[model samples]
Target: MITLKNITLRRGAKVILDGASATINPGEKVGLVGRNGAGKSTLFALLNGSIHEDGGDFSIPAQWRMAQVAQDMPETDESATDFVLAGDTALAAVNAEVAAAEASEDGERMAHAYMALQDVGAHDAPARAQALILGLGFQNPELDRPVNSFSGGWRMRLQLARALMAPSDLLLLDEPTNHLDLDALVWLEAWLQRYAGTLLVISHDREFLDAITNVTLHIESAQLKRYGGNYSRFEDMRAEQLALQQASYSKQQDKIAHLQKFIARFKAQASKAKQAQSRVKALERMEKIGPVLAEADFTFEFKEPANLPNPMLTLQGVSCGYPSAEASAAPTTIVRNVGKSVLAGQRIGILGANGQGKSTLVKTIAGDLKPIAGEIVQGKGLAIGYFAQQELDVLRPQDTPLEHMIRLARDTTQAGRLSGQSTREQDLRSYLGSFNFTGDQVKQAVGSMSGGEKARLVLALLVWQRPNLLLLDEPTNHLDLATREALSVALNEFEGALMLVSHDRALLRAVCDEFWLVTRGGVLPFDGDLDDYQRYLLEEAKRQREAIKASATGQAAASVPAAAATAPVVNSPLNASSTAKPVPRENNRTRQMRKELEQCEARMAALSQEKQGIEARLNANPALDEIQRLSTRMAALQTELDGVEARWLELGNALEAAT
Candidate 1:
C-alpha cells in the first residue's frame, strides 16, 4: 500500500497541503480531484520523490515500486516503442544481466541468470512488447517509425505506455488522457480496467475516471477526504458535505452575533454584569468553520451577442483540400463539390477518418483557411470564438496572469470592472479569482504555472470573449475531472451555437445538439447522440464487410495501404450518389438510421468537393489535428465504401452469369 501521512507542502509563504493524509490499498484505484492550482500535480511530484514537502512524510511499503507518466517527452531520437521501453528500467537491467551471464563461461551464474530472465519475461520479450503495444493503442505499424517523426502528442502516449508497462506496484498518471484520441482513450480505459496494480490518476476526464476508478480523494480545507466509490458517488457526497459545512458556518456566525449583542446590552446593567463577561469570553474562545466552497463554484455568465439572420456561416460549392503537386503528378485534394450552411443553435460535430478533413472543416469555419473552390460567407454580426487544440502555443510565459488578461480585454477603460478602478493590483486579483487564481498566485509568473493552469487560463479568456458562435477544437484537453464537469454544465447553459471538433465522445454527447460527420463524401448531418452515431458506424462496417466478401478479391482496388493511409485522398474518384435524408424530428433509433442513410446520399457530390477543398488547404497549411482526424476518418470510410463497391461488383458478376 502507498500512503501519505500528515503531509504539509508549502511553496515560499503559501501552504498547499496542510496536514493532509491519505492511503491507497493494494489494487485500489483512486482519482484525485481539485481546482486548477490545488496542488494536485505537486502532490504527485511529492509521491514520486521528485519534490520534498516542507513538513510531514509520505509512507509507502519498501517492497512496492512506483512509476509516473511524464507529461512532456524528451527531445531524443528514440523510436516510440523504444521510448516506451525505457520505462522498464528494472526489466532492462535484468535483461542485461542475462546477456552477461550468457557470455560468461561459468555454469552456475548462467542458471541463476536464466531464472531471473524468466521472472522478467526475457524469453518472451516479443509477446510482452506486443501486449504493451495493444494496451497503449500503438497497433499501427507506423508506430515502429522513429518517434521524432510523430508529433508531441503521440510521443506523450509513448511515455504513458512505458510507465504503464514498468514493473511497478503503484501507477501515478497525471493527465494521461490529454494527448490521446477517442479510440485510444477507449483502449486506455479498457487497459486500466484489467491492470492489477494500484492506480492514482489525476485527470479532468469524467467518463474516463468513472469508468476506471473506484474511489476519490479530494483536497480541501487543508485536508484530504477519502470517499469510496466512483466520481458520481464522490460528487454526491461532496455536495452533502459542502451543504453541511455552510449550515454550520451560518449557525456559528449567528451565535457569535447574538453573544456580542447580549454583551453590549448587559455590560452596563449591574444585575447582569457577570453574564455579559461570560458571553465576551465565550466569543473569543469559540472555534470557527470557514465558509464552504462547492468545488470551483465560480459561474460563467456571458453577455449574448446580437443574433444572426442566416446560418452562422455558409459554404457554397466549396472545394477545400491541400495540393501537393511536387509529391504527385497531379495535386491531391480531400474535399470537392461541398456546400453547407451552419445556422444558429446548430451543435455540429465533425467526424471522419484521421485524414478525411475534420479539422480542415473546423479551420475553414473559423476563417483560418480560405476554401479553394467555393465561397464561405460569414453571417452579419457573427461573434466567433475559436479554440485550437494546440492553443498552449499562443500563451506567453514571460507575462503575469494579470498582464495576459489586460492584453485580452476589449476595452482598457472597462478596466474598472476587471481590475479595481485605477488600481491594477485589485483588478488583477479579482479577475484571477474568476479563473481561481488568487492571493500570491496572481503575482506569480505565468511560466511557472502547470499545464492544467494554462489550459484553464485559455478557457477563462475565451469565456470573457462572449462570442455568438463558439468553434472549439478539442477544448476539453488538459482539464481535470471537476473542470470538465463544470465545462459540461457551462456549455449546456450557454446561449451561443457550438461547433466542436473533439475526440471526447462523452463531452460531445453531453453538449452537442447535432452532428456533422465529416467524411470523404463531405459533411453529412446526423443525429448528434454518440450512441446513435456509434450504431451507425457499426452498421456501416457490417454492410461493407458483406460487400467485400461477396465480390471477387481482384475486382476493385479500394483498400488503401495502412502505411499510405495517413495521406490525403486526392486520387480516388467518388461518384456522385443520391443519399439525402431530412433531419429527424425525434432522436429515435429508426428515425436516426433513416436520416443518416439519406444524409449520406445527399452528401456524396458535396463531400467529393469538400475532400478536394480540404486537400488543397492541407497542402497550404499542414496542421496536425486537421490532418490526423481527416486521415483516420477517411480511412474508415474508404474501407466501408470499398465493401459497398465490392458488393456491387459481385452483383454484376451474378447478373452476368444468369444472362
Candidate 2:
C-alpha cells in the first residue's frame, strides 16, 4: 500500500505534478494515465522513491519494496540472457560464479565448476533463458550471443526483461510495452496479470491498461483523481467528468456576468449594491474551475491523392536491413531477397522480432538504404509521404509551424503532378487545423514544441504533401492512446497505400491490410488479419524456443538411467538445488532420450493443467462484468499453449526415436 498527500513535484520550475494526492492499496493495479509530457513517469518515480516530490508525503508499508523498470541501459558485453538473469539479484550472484568458473583455465577447477553448474541447474538455464528471450521478441541469434551487438531498442527490451524478472512488492512500469511486438507484448501482459504484487503502469496502451489496471489514476491540472475502471471505462468516466466540469464552468461564467452588470449598475445608484455583494460572496465560495484543462480531438479530412492507381508498391525477391551472415555468405548482397505486391489502399503492417531488418526494409522503400539485391516497382502517379520513428530528426527545429507547412507546398507548375495554387493562407491554415494546431501555435517555432506537438506537425506536413503512398514508422510514439486511435481513424479513411512499422498491436490492427515480417533470416509476406499475424509470429518464436529446450533437455536428461525414468518427475524449484550425476558413455544415448521425453511430457502436463486452471480463473474473475486484463492474457496463453503442444508432440516422437 502507498499513499501520496499534497504532492508537488517540479522539474526546474516546470510543474510535473501539483498537489497530487492518492492512495493505492496492496493488490491493486492502477494505471497512471495522462497526456504526453504530463509527468506520468515523474509521478511514478515519486511513488517508487527514485525522485523526491517537491511538496507531498507519499507513504506505503515499510515492507513493500518498490521497483521501477528503467527505460535506458549502459552498453555492455553482457548477453541478453545473462542480463535478464541479472534482474534477480540472487540469481545474478549464482550465475556469476558459473561464469567465473567457465573462465578459469585449470582443468581440475573446470571439472569441479562443471559439477557445481549442474547442481545449480545451469544446464537447463539455456531453456529457461531462451523462453524469456523469445517472449521479448529477440529472434536474434545474438541474444544468447551478446548485448553489445544489439541496438538501443533491443537493449531496452533486455532492461525491461530484467526489471520484470526481478521480484518486488510493487512494480512501477513505465511504458513496459513500448519496444515489444505483438508476441512479446502479449506474453508480458499475461505475465503481469499473474504477477503477485501491486502494479502501477504508465502506458498509453489502452488495451494493456484496460486489461491489467483495476483503477485509473488521472494526473491532470496538478491533481490526482482515481477512477474505478480500466481504460475504456475510464474514458467513459472522463467524458462524464468533462461534461460536469464544462457545465459548472458555464454556469459560473453566466452568474459572474450577471454580477458584473449588477456591480457596475449599483456602484453609482446603490439600488442593487446588496445583490452585487451577495454575488461576489457566491463567486468567492465557488470552487474555481479546477485547473482549466483543454480537450483536443484530432478530426482530420483525408486529402485523397490525385490520380491514385492500384498496386502502389511492390517488392519481389527484395529484402531490407543490414545483411545477416546467411545472406552475406552468398554474394555481396546483404539485404537478402523477399517478395510482395502491395496493391491499392493496402494498409500493410511490417512486423518482425526486433533486430530484424524491418527498419532496413522500410528504409530501402524510403530510399534511405540500398537493398543488397532485389526488385522494387512503384505504381504510376505514386507520390511518397514518409514518417520515421524519430519525428524530431525528420522535422526542422528552425522551422515554424506555418513555415513547415509552406515548405510542404509543391510548386504545381514545376512538379506538374498536382495543383500549384497552394498558398500559405489556405494550405498552411488547413494543414495545421487538420492536426488541431491553432492560434499562436501556428507561428511557434518547432523547436519550442513538445514531442506531441512535433508529432502533430509531422502529420500535418505529411497531409499537406498528399502523397499517394504513406510510409509511417512508429508514428504512435508521442501520441496518447486517444490520439493514436484518432490517427488510426484518419489513416483508415486516408486514400493511400500505407506501409507502417510499429510495435503497437492495436494500431497495427487498425491500419494494416498486409504485413511484411523481416526476420533476421529473411522477409516473409503475411497476408492475414491482426490475429493471424500475431499467431504466426508467436508460433515461430515459440517453436524456436521449444527446439532449444528440446536440445538442452535431451542433453540434460541423457545423464539418467532409462530403466529409472519410469518414476514421475517431482516438482523442482527453478533455483539451483538439485545435484546431477554424469552417465557412463554406454548409457548416455538412451538416458538422454528419456530425459528429453520427460521434459516434453512435463511441459505438456503443465500446459494442459494451466489451460484448464486459467479457464476456471477467468470464469471466476471478480470484475467479470468489467472487461479485464486476464481476458487478453488468457487468449494469448491459449495461443502459446497451442504452439507448445504442437512442438511437444514433435519432440515426443523424436525422443521415442532416440530411445
Candidate 3:
C-alpha cells in the first residue's frame, strides 16, 4: 500500500499540494484526474520518486516494482521487438546471472541460473514483446523495423508497449490513449482489465477511465480527494456535493437556464444509437448532468450561418488521398469512389482503423487536399469551417490570436466570403474575448499557450466564420473533460452540417447522428452505432493476429532445412504436372499446409482450455453480472470452436488428397 499523510508539495515557489493526504491500496486501478495545469503530472513525478514532498509523510512499499512509460523521445535504432524485450528486467537479470555462472564454471550456480531463467519465462520473451507491439497497433513486419524509423507518435506507442511488457506491481500510464486509434485503444482497455497490478493513469479520455478504472483520484485546490467508482460516478458525486452548497445554487440555476436551450435541442434530435440500450441510458444520464456541465469555465456557441444550403456539398465518385510530390507520379488513393452528400443539419462521424483515410476524407472535404479524381460540387456561397488534426496546419506559432483573427478577417473580406464583416482591431479583440482570449493573452504567441488554449483559438477562428459546414478531425485530442463538454454543447447548438473524425467516443456519441466507415479503399455507411463498431474492431484485431500467426508459422516452415524433414512427400493432383525427382522432397504447398494444420491444432487446444476455465468459473457461482459476461464469452468461444473444427476437417481432406 501507498500512503501520503499531510503532504505538502511545491514546484519552486508555487504550492501544488498543501496538506494533501491519500491512501492507495494494493492492486487498485486509480485514475488520477484534474483540470489541465492542476499539478497532476507533478504529483505523478513525486510518486515516481523524481522529487520529494516539501513537507510531511509519503511512503510506498519498498518491494513494489514500478513501471512507467518513459517520456523521453527514444533515439535508438534497435528493432522494435528487441527494444520491448529489454523491458523485461527480471528476465534480463536472470540471463545476466546465467552468464556469470557460466563464466565461473560453478555447477550449483549454473543450475540455479538455468532454473531462474525458466522461471522468468525468458524463452518466450520475444513472443511476449511482439504481442505487446502488435496489440498497440504495430504490424507484424514492423516488429522487426528499427524504432527510430517510426514517427514521433508511433515511437511513443512503442514506449507504451515497452512499459506494459515490464513485470511490475505498479504501472503508471499518462495519456496512454492519445496516440492510439480506436481499435488500439479497445485492445489496450482489454489488456489493462486483465492486468493484476496497481495502476495509476492520468488521462482526459472519460470513456477510457470508465472502462478500465474503478477508483478516481481528483486533485483540486491543492488537495487530493479520493472517490470510489469510475469517472462518471465521481462526476455525479461531485455534482451532488456542489448542489448542496447554498451560495452556488443560484449561480448553478442561472447556468442551468442557459443550458436549457441545449437540452431542448438534444431532446429534439433523438439518439442515432436508439437500438443500443446502454447508449440510451447514457443519453438519459447526460440530461441529468446538464447543470454540472454548465458550470464549466469555458463555453461558446457558433453564430448563425450567413446562409443555409440544403446540400452543403456533393461528392461525385470522389477519391480522397494524398498527391505525389513528383508531377509524373500518380496520387496515392486511400478512400476511393466516395459518392456522398452532406446536407444541412447532418452530423456524420467518420470511422476507420489507423491509416484507413478517415482524416483524408475530412481533409478533402475541407478543401485542404484536392480529390485525386471526380468532382466535389459545393453549394453557391457555401462556407466551410475546418479544424485540422495538427495545430501547425491552421496556426502560426509566432503569431497571436489577434494576428490570426485579423488576417482571417482581411482575407475572408477581400475574398468576398465575409462580405461587410468588420475587420477592425477592436471588433476582432471582442470576438476573440468570447473564446476566452482577453487582455494580454490576445498578444501572447500561440506557441506559448497550452494545448487547450491552442484548440480554443482554433475553435474561435472556426466559429467566427459562421460556416454552413464544419469539418473537424480529432479536435478533442488536447481538450480536458470540461472543455470537451463545452465543445459538445456548442456543437449541439450549432445549426450546421458537421463531419468529424475523432477517437473521442464521448464527443462522437454527443455530436454525430450518423457514421461513415472508411475502409478497403472505399467509403460506405456503417449502418450501426459506436458499440457495434467497437465490437467489429475487436473481431478485426483478432483476425489480424491470427493471420500474423499463420504468416509466422509459414515463415518458420520455409526456413527449415530440407534435410531435416521427417514427413514423406507426395504429389497431389494440384501439382501433378511437376516432374518427380529421384530423391523425395517436400513441396512448398505441402509444407505450408502442414504448418497451417499445426497452427489450427494449437488454436483448438487453446480454445478448449479457455472454455474449460470459463466453465469452472461459471460452476463456482459468480455474481449475476459476472455470470452474464462469462456466458457471452462462452458462447463466442463455442462459435469459434465450431469454425475451427470445420476448417480442421477441410485441412484433413486436403492433406488426404495430397497423400
Candidate 4:
C-alpha cells in the first residue's frame, strides 16, 4: 500500500502540489490523470522517492519491488535478449552466485545457490525474456540483434519490454502505448489484464485508462482528488459534481446581487443608514463561492478540398519494397501484387503486425517509396499530404512555428500550387491560432515545445497543404485525448480519401469504414472487425508456439543419427535434393551460430555509423559537454566492437568445422 498526507511538492519556485493527500491500496490499478504539467509526473516522482515532500508524509512498503520504464535512451552493444534478461536483477545475482560456488568447489554453498536459482525460476528466464520480446512485436531474428541497431521508437519498445520482464510488486508506466501499433497494443492490454502487481499509470489515452485501471486519481487546483472507478466513470462523477457546483454558485450570486441593490438604495437615507451598514457588513462577512470553471476544449477541421476525383489513386499489381544498393540489382519486395483503387470518400485503415509491410504500403501510396514491380496512377491534379510516424523527423527543430509556416508558404508559392493560396505573416498567425498556438507561442522554437505541440504543428503544416488525399501513419502518437478527439472529428468530416495507420483503436473505429489487412507479403481486405482481428492474433500466436515446439522436437531427434557416418551432415539451402542425389541435413547448432554471427556483423555496422555521426558532430563544433559525452560513448562502443569481432571470428571457425 501507498499513502501520502498533506504532501507539498515544488519545482524551484513553483508549487505543483499543495496539501494534496491520497491513499492507494495494495493491488489497485490506478490511473493518474490531469492536464499537462498538473503535477501528475511530480506525484509519481514523489512516490518513487526521487523527490521528497516539502511537508507531510509519503510511505510505501519497503519489501515491495518496483519497476519502471526508463526515460533515457540506452546506448550499448548488448543484445536485446540480454538487455531484457538484465531486468531481473535478483535472478541474475542468484545465477552469478551459483557460477562462483561451482568454480570454488563449495558443496554446501553450491546447493544453496542452486536452490535460490530454482526459487526465482532462473532456469526459465531466457524463455520468459523471449516471450516478452515477441509479445512486444519483435521478430525472432531481432532478438539477437544489438539494442543500438534499432531506431529510437523500437528502442523505446525494448525499454518497455525490459520493464515488463522484471518481477515486481509495483509497476509504474507513463505513456506505455505511445510507441506501439494496434497489434502490440492489444497484446499489451491482455498482458496487463493478467498482471497481479499493483499498477499506477499516467497516460493521455482515455480508452487505455478505461480498459486497464480500476481507480482514477485526478490532480486539479493543487489538490489530489480520488475517484472510485475507471476514467469513464470518473468523468461521469466529475460532471455531476460540476453541475451541482454551478447551480449553487448561480443561487448565491442572485442573493448577493439583491443584497447589493438594497444597500445602494438605503445607504443614502439617514434613517436607513444604520440598517444599510449592517447589511453591508453581513455581505462582506459572508464566505464567497467562486463559479465553476469548465475544462478547455480544442476543435479544428481540415479545409474542404477544391477537387475530389472519383478515384484518387489506383495501384495495379503493385509490389512495394526498397531498392538494392547495386545498380542492376532487383528490388527487395515486401508487399507483392497489390491491386487497389482508393476512392475520394474512402476511409481505409491499414492493419497488420509490426514489420509486416503496413508502412511499406503507405509509403508506396504516398510516393515516398517507388513500387518495385507495378505502377501507381494518380488522378489529375491530385494533391497528397503525408504524415510520417516520426513527426519530429519531418520538422525543423530549431525553427519556430511562424518560420515553418513562412517557409511552407514560400515553397508553395514558388512551386505554383493551386489548392492553398499564399498567405502573409498575419494570416498564418490567425491560422495557427485555431490550432491553439496563439500570441507569443507562435514564436516559440519547435525544439523547446512539448510532444503535443510538435504534433499539432505537424498537423497545421499538413492542413495548409490542402491535399485531397491523406496518408497518416500514427498521427495521434504524441497527441492528448482532446486533440485526438478533435482530429477524429475533423477526419470524419473530411471529404477527401484517407489511409490511416494508427494504434488508437478509438480513432480507427471512429474514422475508418473499411479495413485492409497486410499479412504474409500480401494486401487483402479483412472481412471482420477489430474484435475478430484480435481473436486472429491470439490464434496466430498459439500457432507460432506450436510450430516452434515441433521444430525443436525434430531438431533434438535429428541430432542422433540412425548409424554413424564417415562425414558430418551439412545442410544448405543451395544443396537441393533431387531423385538422383540427396543433400545432408544442417545441424541446429551451426544455424544458431551463423545467425548470431550475422547479428554481430549488424551490430558492428551500426557502431561504425554511430562513429561517423560523432565525427560529423565534432566537425560541426558541438558544445563542450556534448562533445565529452559523445567522445566517451564512442570509446566504449569501439571497445565493445572489438569484442564482437573476436566472437564473430570464433563463430565463423566453429561453423566451418561443423560443415
TM-score of each: 0.70, 0.70, 0.78, 0.82
Tens digits of per-residue lDDT, candidate 3, 335-357, equal 68999899999999999876666
Give all candidates' CA lDDT scores: 0.70, 0.71, 0.83, 0.84
Error of 4 at 546 (Å): 6.2
What local lDDT does model 4 show for residue 391? 57
Give the Cα-based TM-score of candidate 3 against the true structure: 0.78
lDDT of 3: 0.83
Candidate 4 has which clashing residue pairs, if any?
A: none
Segments in model 3 whose C-alpha atoms lie over 4 Å from true places: 247-296, 546-659
Between candidates 1 and 3, name the one with more favorable TM-score.
3
- Most accurate candidate by TM-score: 4
Candidate 4 residues 438-486, lDDT tens each?
9999999999999999999999999988889999998998998889999
Task: By lDDT, rank the candidates, best first.
Answer: 4, 3, 2, 1
Two-way lDDT contest, 2 vs 3, winner: 3
